[model samples]
Target: MSITPQAQISAQDKSYSAKALVSIALAWAFDAMDFSILTFVLVDIMKDYGVPLTLAAAVSSATTFARLGGGFLGGLIGDSWGRKAGLVISIIWFTIFEFLTGFSIGFTLLFLVRILYGIGMGAMYANGTPMLMEMMPAKWRGFASGLMQSGFSFGYIFAAIIYRVWYGDLGWHAMFYIACIPALVVAIYIWAQVPESSRWRKEKSASKSHSVPVSHLFKDGNTWNTIHAALISLIAFGVTYPINIFYATLLKQHGHFSPAIVANTIIILNVAGIIGNILGGYLSDIIGRRAVLIISAIGTLACSFVFQSISTDWERNLFTFLIGLFSIGGVWAAIPTYIAEHFKTTVRSTGQGTTYHFGAAVGGAIIPLIVSGIAPSVGGLAHAMTYSVAITSILVIVLAVLWRESKGSVLE
Candidate 1:
């Protein structure tokens, strides 16, 4: 049957459910935690497994490259099979590899395992963001999207807690092990608790009667959707990726900080991010997604400069917090929700996931190589970051201006 009349909105669309939002948010948090956990423990893994800093970074980059593929595959699965299927499989798939990475004997084994984990992660974002966005009321789409994206901050904070309590004594393997518990728990929760995307199921059945899938997105006015979302994803992470991924590395190498200081700095950055996620999410509801992007781009550009200037512990803590808040916490408030607006339900996850993960691959995996490669000649990572932020922020603003604002628009 079609969407019930009383519950129907924006034509036949149904109101967003809190249950779906919470389920997707929890799953997204574990995905974020999975990614963040590795970032915190990478240095120790390098020392333990006998690899140089460059190789270790390459291992991380490899996972990102793999994710580009994973995201596309997962998006297809999500759109074709069901969001719940992709959701459960991706969570369990990644967590298993994450647990096994702890037992790896060499860089090759670790690299292969992480590549598989990246695949799972790529799928997670593809499935999770669209799954949640498709279910929400247009009025609360920004709020719902931010709630799902904010899981990254929660995951980062949890990873920091692991580093604070266990990194000194238990080491990198234990950090990977800690991630397994949550992964298993959440995977079970998702299968047992979360419902499939009613929207996808309804549309899928409708289209099958015609035997040809909806072809509107690939042509006409919507042609640039996939490209636009991907570019937006790339720019969002332009500063966010390098800043968070290299937080520990930058503080230790550039600022000459001890391990204790680095851990504290990470925690502070994520704490500020949690607040910014909420603030930006609500503001997008009030102001609009484009405004949130402009505000975030400007904030990230300005804060990145301050972030590069850190020397003292106070400087590191304060600036790290600001960078996290502005670069990701704010931009994330609207990005996934905004991207969801670019496509109808059938291709929503596909468009959002493909571009977003490709962006992640570039931002998370590729950009660091450029910065680190130039670090020796450029004075340090700080100067490289300053230049990157200036350039990326302008690009992000340009995209935000050009991309239509989708605030309060109903999902099709």
Candidate 2:
């Protein structure tokens, strides 16, 4: 029930509302679903592509490379033109390539398809947070941010459902085809329904169509701050990607979990995540972003230890639920809000998007490969996750302590 102390909206701007927030989040949901799809269906991809398990895992990370380029370009386009057009173009580009991914015949061909797919992923994610951050009123920015971040969890939840009903019978490729279609529809709908960002429009009018260079982010007072923030995202990716991206595969192959059990667990975890996202953001509005982040980091650290110590399936499930709560919901709830508060409107989208996505690309693309390589040497996937999570949790705590608190700050 906490609120930001003051709400900032333009005196003449009358079009801002929650509907715009929902539309942006809807676009992002597809990105989350696509990312999660690799986790659930990697085995199928390996079998179909005639590649080894390492290559299969590498493909999961492959999109990250393409995304680096996509994020930069999308941010440039969004900042230069408009958030809406950038998103629509990004969605369409990803949708077509993702559909093409289903038809890839060989490992190289599939990898190439996925690289293109990453572009769309990068573009939308780059644009999504800042667009929402700019449009929503200050009082609700935290909650709005939480909802935007949880768009991925919601997408992950649906992917779990899809795996249950359609994945087994229709197969993974069919799932990709089906998932890509919704993205296209969402793109068209976003094009028709969502308004241009009111903040961006107002600024453009005031400046008479001047453009800001992306390189200027490096020259600002936030130069190091941006790097440190991006490092936080990188560490987030390092901890979460290995454990989450391959969790279902671990359960099914090693832990002897039934597909139903895996699907149900995924659903419950993400549902809890959605709640954590909203609650954590609301709490951050009252307390401070750094405090909520520290709380989240400590919770995640506790979860990691509990995970390593526990052996029973029930206990693992309990810990998994908490991990979803703290790691996915808690940490993510404050990130967009925190990042938005750090930069001016002229460079907000570019600065925030580039740092976040660059970290994501490096972590997403590389960590899975490392995990796949180290899992054998480190005893197993579970052990590898334990160590990675432990290290990243400590880093998060350190960063949280160092990063300045931005509680209840209005967006530029």
lDDT (C-alpha, whole model) for all candidates: 0.79, 0.79
What is candidate 1's CA lDDT for residue 77? 80
Instruction: Give every collision pair in model 1.
Output: none
Number of the top candidate by TM-score? 2
lDDT of 1 by residue, 1-412 (tens): 6766665644434323676787678777777777787777667777887776667778778888888888888888888888889888888888888898788778788899999999998888888888887777778888888777888888887887887788789877778888777777877877886778778888888875433233655666777876788888887777677777777777776677777777788878888887788789878999998998899888887877765667865666777788788776897788888888888877776677788888888876888767667766877777877777777888989998898878888778
User: What's the TM-score of every candidate structure?
Assistant: 0.92, 0.93
lDDT of 2 by residue, 20-65 (tens): 6777787788877876887898777777767777888887777887
lDDT for residue 12 in candidate 1, whole number 0-100: 38
RMSD of 2: 3.8
In model 1, what is the error at residue 121, expressed in angstroms? 0.6
